[model samples]
Target: MRAVFVRPGGGGVEVRDVDVPEIGEGEILVRMRVCGIDGTDLEKAFGRPITPPMLGHEVAGEVVESKTSEFRPGDRVFVHHHVFCGRCYYCLHGSYTMCPLFLKTTIEPCGLAEYFRVPRTNVERGAVLKLPDNVGWEEAAFIEPSACVLRAINRAGFRPGDSVSIVGVGPTGAIFIRLLKSFGASVVAAADLSSFRLEAARRLGADIVVNPLEADFPEECRGATDGRGVDIGVLATPTVKPLQTVLDTIRKGGVLLIFGAPEKGEKAEIDFSKLFLRETNIVTSYSTSEVETNLMLSLIASGRVSLRDLITHRFRLEEAEEAFQTARDAGRSLKVVVEA
Candidate 1:
């Protein structure tokens, strides 16, 4: 079998022949169908590298072998890469993503492979979700990212009809727009430097779209909310450049949700006194556990939301490098997927 691995020292992705992953008791082997290329995957490939170097996680596939009766060889599913131990302190506190076991557990050899093993721990914890017959591989590939957005909304205690502002209208940002509107947000203001993404946001139901380069993002957000500022401000880009800008777009007592994880050592300057005086709250969301993934799956299955249009580019596994390049071009592309 062949798998995509991030080239060491940040060059790009390389496909190499590797032995097929073997399944053991309570484990399952899945043949990859399609996997979404995430911003983190591009970071690992062309920027700084993170541990394990397993590139893809937004994946969907078919079970080729199963050792547990919970799933069969022919099951078509979306497998979550991380699962928490329900007994851990984090899980007990409802911080499932912070469970120590969550980060340590993952799909074997990564999701960007011809085949990968679902560990017993993940299987037992209900990490695999069967796809509805109506869902396609691309739609299934969106489960993880959508789950992540759902967690951020949950953490921020988002209220329906609250005015929202998104600082980065990338693929995930688009998801935020779709979900927020479905939940009855009164208005959504999307900001991005890229006109392409701004247009995409408008098409996805944003009431207002602003190119920060052309207009003041904070002003635009405030203008849309009748000068009260947005009730919720979301930072969806991985860079900290727009952190304070996003923060400035929130109303007093509003919530600023940092949904993007910046590279280590990246810093942003903000007015601590202003935040304190204004009663502004800051919330950070990490990866999702099965709790959010299941909800995301149900939403997709129930036709409450669709991610099909967010997929702007698709490539074969052999064209993984090209896919990475396209993903890097945020001005032109949204979600890029690699088909097996």
Candidate 2:
């Protein structure tokens, strides 16, 4: 089987002939249909928190073989990227993602391969969900990221009539905008340096789009909320500046959600006096779990969220390099998928 893997020492991904993963008891084998190339994949390729073995996590495919009776050959499914240990302290306390074992495990042989193995833990623990007939492989591949957005929005706790401001109109940011609107937010504003992303955000139902480079973003957000500032501000860019902007745009007693993963060791300064006196809150979200992933799958299947509009490009496994390049230059692209 052919697989795209990260070479050691920050080298680019290389196509290699690797053995197909073997299925264990209660495990399932999926014939890869489509894998979403994320910003994390770019970070991994550059050797940030470098880990060997499989890399791709946002995957969807047909069940080629299975040892469990719950699933069988020809069943379409979406694979959950992370697996949690049920006996861990975090799991016992309902903080499954914080479990040490979940962080230690990786999807064997990665998602960017001709075939990959689904762990017994994921299958038995309800990590994998059957894809609906109306959803195609490309749209189903978005389930992972959509689940992440769902988790972030849930943590932010937006009220039905709350004013919302989102910084960064990338794939994740755009998804956040759509979800926020669906939650009945009264005012939805999105900011990004790229006009392409801002346009994409508009298409995703953002009420207002602001180009941070050409406008006073904080002032614009403030004006949009009638000088009270937005009720909630979501920082969806990996840059530290956006975090500060989120803080500035959020009103007193408002919430700030940091949804983007900044580079390691990144730092930003904030006005402690404002945070203290205003009683503002700051929160960050990481990966998604089985529970949230299942919800996102349902939402996608129901047509409440459109994953089709988010996919702007697709590449084959052999075009992995080109796909990475396109993702790196995200100003012109939204979500890029690599098909098997």
Candidate 3:
């Protein structure tokens, strides 16, 4: 088996031969077809701690072997890396991601490998989704990420005809724009440093595109919204350095949703006085659950949202290094996929 291994402390990525993992009872082995690469994979590769160490997780593949009768060899599927134990206290309380079982389950050897094992815990907990014949492999690869964005949209209290300002217009931001448009958001403003991303957002339905490097983002949002700012401001970038700018772009009673993920120990200096004076609320949505995954799969299978639009680059499994680097380069790519 061939897999891409990331060494800790920025050691670099290694594409080498390793033993193909043997699945235990009730487990399934997936022969990778394609996998999506995002910032989290980059973090794991360049030396941050991401558990199950081998690292890729937005996977779409075919079943090579399965211990369970429900699935068979040759079945195409999407492996949900995290699964929760329904009987647990966290599950009962609706904190599915917080369940200890959910935090620990993952595909063996990781999604970057040519083949990986799906644990029994994952399969039994609805982590394994069999793809319909109508769904293509590349589109199936998007189930995990789209599920994540769907969860965030649900938590955002988003409504039809509402106004919005997105702080970052990367691949995830594009997904937000597409879904927001479906909900009939009248004003969709996107802010970014990249003209390519901003343009992409526009094609997806952003009415106003602002480059903070060239003009004031808050002022742009206000101008777009008749000086009331936006109804909801989304901080889609990974750093909080833009926290104040995003906060200032929202109406006093609006919500500022932090959707981008930051590294460990990353801190933001926010003014308590300002926050107290304004009634703006801050919220965040973490990893998705089986519930959200079901919806995402249906949305794709039904052709309501096309993940294919986000696919800007594709590389062979052997070109793993270049693929990772391309995904890291914001000026060049949207969604980068590694195909086996």
Candidate 4:
């Protein structure tokens, strides 16, 4: 099997001929059809908090082998990236991503490989979902990221008719725009430094688009919201300054959802006095859970969110480096996928 893997330290990824992962009892082996390249994959390549063997998580594939009776050898499925210990306190409380064991596990030799193994927890607990016939492999790859955005929107307590401003129009941010609009958000404003991303956001259902480099973004969002500021602000960029801008643009009692993962040790200068004076709520969403992934798949199957619109590029497994470069280069992509 061919796989893309990162070196132990901070180094670039390389394509290598590796052995196909062997499934243990209760495990299932998937022959990957497509793997989505994400921001986290970039972080792992540079030796951010994630350990080595990192490559992909958002995967859509067909089952080539399995030891479990619930799934057969020909089922098309989407793998939930994380594995949680059912006995952990976090898992007991339904906060699976917070489980220490979950944080330690790596999906790599992940979905980027020609074939990957699905853990027993993911298989038996319904984390792995069968893709509908209408959903193509490329679109199915978006389930993971869409699920993360869904979780973030839920955490922000987004209500129908809420005014929302999303800072950053990357793949995840675009998904946020679509989901917010589907949920009845009347006013959706998107801010980004790149004109290409801003345009993509508009096509994805943003009511207004603002280029932060060309205008006062926070002020523009406020103006669009009739001076009350947006009801919710989603910080989808890793930059600390954008996060600050999100906090600044939200209404006094508005919610600020930090959905993007910043580099380690990243910090922002926030006004503590203003936070105290105005009842502002700050929340952050990390990864997605099984429940969210299922719901995202359902939404895709229902045509509420079209994953086809998000895909911008596709590469073979051997072209992993080029795929990463395409994703890294702004104005070039909405999402890049590696097909096996």
In model 3, which residue pairs have backbone atoms overlapping below 3 Å? Answer: none
Per-residue lDDT value at 269 in model 4: 85
Model 3: per-residue Cα lDDT over 1-340, one tens digit each: 8898785456467788989999999999999999998767776776444344657889989999989988999999999899988888989998887788877888888899999999998988889999999999999888888888888877878888889898888778888888888768989888888888877887887888889999898998889888999988998886668888888899888998888777667789887787878888888877789899899899888888787788889999889999988887778787899998
Q: For candidate 4, lDDT tens digit of each residue in 1-340?
A: 7898875565677889988888889989999999998878877776354333467999989998989988999999999867677788889997877888766665546888999988787777677899889988988988999899988898889989999999988888888888888889989999998888888987887888988778887898888888889999999985667877888779989998888778778778888999878789998889988878989899999987776678889899999888888887668788889988
Give candidate 3 regions above 4 Å deviation. Answer: 47-52
What are the runs in model 1 whose C-alpha is more than 4 Å off?
49-52
Best by lDDT: 1
The alpha-carbon lDDT assigned to residue 87 of candidate 3 equals 83
lDDT values for all models = 0.89, 0.84, 0.85, 0.84
Q: Give the TM-scores of the predictions, in the order they appear.
A: 0.98, 0.95, 0.96, 0.95
- Candidate 4 achieves a global lDDT of 0.84
Give the least accurate 10-residue stretch of model 4, judged by summed lDDT: 45-54
lDDT for 324 in candidate 2 is 78
Candidate 3 has an lDDT of: 0.85
On the 0 to 100 scale, the lDDT of residue 241 in model 2 is 76
Which segments of candidate 4 are over 4 A away from where they belong? 50-53
Off by over 4 Å in 2: 50-54
Q: Residue 56 lDDT in model 4?
A: 93
RMSD of 1: 1.1
